[model samples]
Target: MKAMILAAGLGTRLRPLTLDRPKPLVDVHGRPLIEYNLLLLRRYGIVDVIINLHHQGDALRAALGSGDTLGVRIVYSPEDPLLDTGGAIKNAASLLGDDDFLVLNGDTIIDLPLDALLAAHRARRAAATLVLRHDPEQQRYGLVEIDGEERIRRFLGRPAEVETALVPYMFAGVHVLSSRVLDYMPDPGTTFSITRATYPAMLAADEGLYGFPFAGFWRVIDTAADLARANAILEERPPLHFL
Candidate 1:
């Protein structure tokens, strides 16, 4: 399996902590935030990885050179002007090759059965399978609606109106995407968002978009409080089983 870590964000939410380093490089329990994702990918036996870089790109590069220490072959796609999720993936289309690949947010720490997620994606033959979780603050993160069959029906808050009062599920910042979904993305070199643009289009077209609900440990460290909480969690439970 192959994976891509979306680490190109400017980390504006993290402010002072990110001023010296990228959000992915922010220290969490004495380990870089991105390290948790890398280790998880390694745990799943996905050794080929690409990381998109922007703010503090050099520091990230210096922090994890070639992914050798982590037992993964790492390549970088540095965007001059940071491209959002859609554009970043399109920019690395060639490197990702013509197969399904995993996408993980650098700021998130999650421990779930990735193998099962892959199995479900293959079984459904979905073009894009998002890992969803029931977050109480769904509105804060934006919601995704899924049907009985787990097909993604809509991206809440989009321009389109959803007739049904569908329950909202938060995107877990993890995705298993088939290469063909890249076609739904805007032209390469253009800044775009997968949620606001590509995903809505895919749902409209009835493409094979699905969701896998996960009830496990997942945290996104976007603010100082989040960072502190993560550190506290690690302090209470040193050496997370996932890592």
Candidate 2:
């Protein structure tokens, strides 16, 4: 399987620390943030990894050289004007190729059962399976509503309104997507957020998009406080214990 990590963000939220290094290269428990994701991908037997870079991109490139130490082949998609999530994925389409691949946020730390998520994706025969978790504060972030069969009924903060018994779950910054999803995106654009544009279109078309609910430890490390919490958790005990 192949995968791409969206790492081109400027890390505006993580100031001072990110001023000198990219968010992906920011130290957390002695290892660069992106390194953890690479190791996790290696464990899942996914070696073909593509990462996009912009903020302190050269440092990140130097730090991750060829991913040899991590047992994976790392490829880079260097973007000049930072592209948003949808734009970055669309820009790296050639590297992603013509099949389904895993997409994850470079800064998110989550102990996801990759095999289980993939299995659930295939069973549902979904066009895309979003790794979702039911968070009480789901309103803070973009939410996805899924039915009993796990098919996505609607995406929050979008125009598509569904009257079904929909449970809102926060997107876990991880997904298994078919290349076909790009069909809804423009070839070249300034910036586009996938949640704001693509997923809603898919939902309106009644396309098979499902949520892979995982009640596990997951954190999106964007601010310094998030990094501190992660370090405390990882330093005090092994991450596997929480899993």
What value does the lDDT take at residue 157 in candidate 1?
55
**lDDT score at residue 131, model 1, on the 0-100 scale:** 96
lDDT of each model, Cα atoms only?
A: 0.88, 0.85
Q: Candidate 1 regions off by >4 Å? A: 158-164
Q: How many backbone clashes does candidate 1 have?
A: 0
Per-residue accuracy of model 2 over 95-189 as CA lDDT, tens digit each: 99998999999998888889999998888778999998976655656778878878887777623244335557878889999888989888854
Per-residue error for 74 in candidate 1, Å, reads 0.5
Model 1 global lDDT (CA atoms, 0 to 1) = 0.88
Candidate 2 minimal-lDDT segment of 10 residues: 158-167
lDDT of 1 at 110: 90
**TM-score of each model, paired residue for residue:** 0.95, 0.92
